[model samples]
Target: MVSLPEELQAREAAARQRMEELQAEAAELAVRLERARADLSRWEITRETVVQVLAELSAAEAVPEVVARDASDPKDAPAPHGIGVMAVPPWREGLVAGVLPDVYRDIVEIVADAPGPLQAKQIVPRIRLEATTAKIEGTRGKLKRLVERGWLDEDTPGRFTLARHYGDTGRVNSR
Candidate 1:
């Protein structure tokens, strides 16, 4: 029994109230999103700090063994304690070949044998692949994945070295 004008006025008021509620909800969501982003940033920094600390601790612990090994003549130095005649630890002899796919294994082998950090292009020839643009790019992708998997280290941008744990001394076997 309300007049048309009154009904229209009521509808307009409801629409305005709904708009205000939506605006408040949007503001709340924005605030929550910002807080979540800040929390993520804090966690990322904490993770990086922890990783750096652990790397430093590992390096510090390895110093004495490296020094001792280096001081002794190659002929006179005692063989590593638990690693018998195997050049690599029995568990790690097939580590790359066992854990990784064929292409990744090839990449690790190439990096491991290199005298210094290698770029993707330098790895391509050793892998026996044509130096095409796509192949080189794919090699780069595989190298990055190896870095993520802790099998390689990016010594600098576009240059990779085998991760320190896999060094010549077989340090990882001691662990």
Candidate 2:
């Protein structure tokens, strides 16, 4: 379908003949694809220094009472050497169960351990914290916020009930 000038047409036919003659000299590059991939794969850094740095970084993610609202109870609180905020209460067993961070785990423990509803004032002294966790007001906010999040039931104006058992508050499963 493609047309050319008569002189160009003859030149094109000659070019095709040359291409066919040279075909045996040129090899397909399909095998180079995997070789290039293998070369790229070799650039990966598996050095111990890089791995050690990453390990230290992962260790650094510890939860504090103020920032992470982490819910780590004293019992499960890991040694403070690592990055990840202490052991955040591993997200509880069921679906409605929250993914409590290390700080919240402590709050959950404190709330659940108490005999009954506890006021923020009452809970202030009970929380076991070191210099790393800052002060009481931050912890109070964590507790109150947990109540609002349905992790605990607030009784009076400021008292809280541990909602670890009766989760999802009063919502009934109609099924």
Candidate 3:
């Protein structure tokens, strides 16, 4: 008993209402997404803090043991007059390699093999990459990051050497 125009108008009004409902649902979803992003950011910060604390604790624990062992064993002590006669074993190359990106590993390899500290320019050719300025700069950045992470030492300005703990010999210290 409904007229045609009335039926069409009713359908149009229902569609409009449905559209409004969908818009509300979308707004709610947007708010949830924002909350999830904030939560993820918070979790990332917490994880970083936990990791740092654990590392510091582990290092602190290691020092006392090393010191005690060295004090008990005369052979373990450093040579007289501040000289270190024993070649301290290098850190595990595989361990270092596993954490590094390919470019960074390559840079480490190049530096480790060098007879002396190398400048960024000197390292580029040994890596066998196209010697573009960008590549050189990127290599420099990786070197700086490695130094920051204690993987390498800046022996002189703009030149780098492997840290004492990462000696070229690839031998792991028995201690």
Give the residue spans of candidate 2 off by over 4 A. 1-98, 129-134, 164-175
Q: What would the per-residue lDDT of candidate 3 be over residues 1-175, giving only the tens digit for each residue?
A: 9999999999999999999999999999999998897677567557755764555444444433323454777887544433442111233444454334445667777777788899998887887754656557767876888887766789798999877663455422222
TM-score of each: 0.41, 0.36, 0.41
lDDT of 2 by residue, 44-77 (tens): 3234336645544463553234334335666455
Per-candidate count of clashing residue pairs (backbone under 3 Å): 0, 23, 0
Question: How much does each candidate deviate from the true structure in C-alpha RMSD?
Answer: 13.2, 19.2, 12.4
Ranking of candidates on lDDT, top first? 1, 3, 2
The CA lDDT at 118 in model 3 is 94
Two-way TM-score contest, 2 vs 3, winner:
3
Model 1: CA > 4 A from native: 1-97, 166-175
Per-residue lDDT of model 1, residues 81-121, tens digit only: 32222212122343543334445667777777777899999
What TM-score does candidate 3 reach?
0.41
Model 1, position 105, has a per-residue lDDT of: 67
Instruction: Report how far residue 163 has shifted in candidate 2, in Å.
Output: 2.3
- The lDDT values for all models are 0.66, 0.55, 0.66
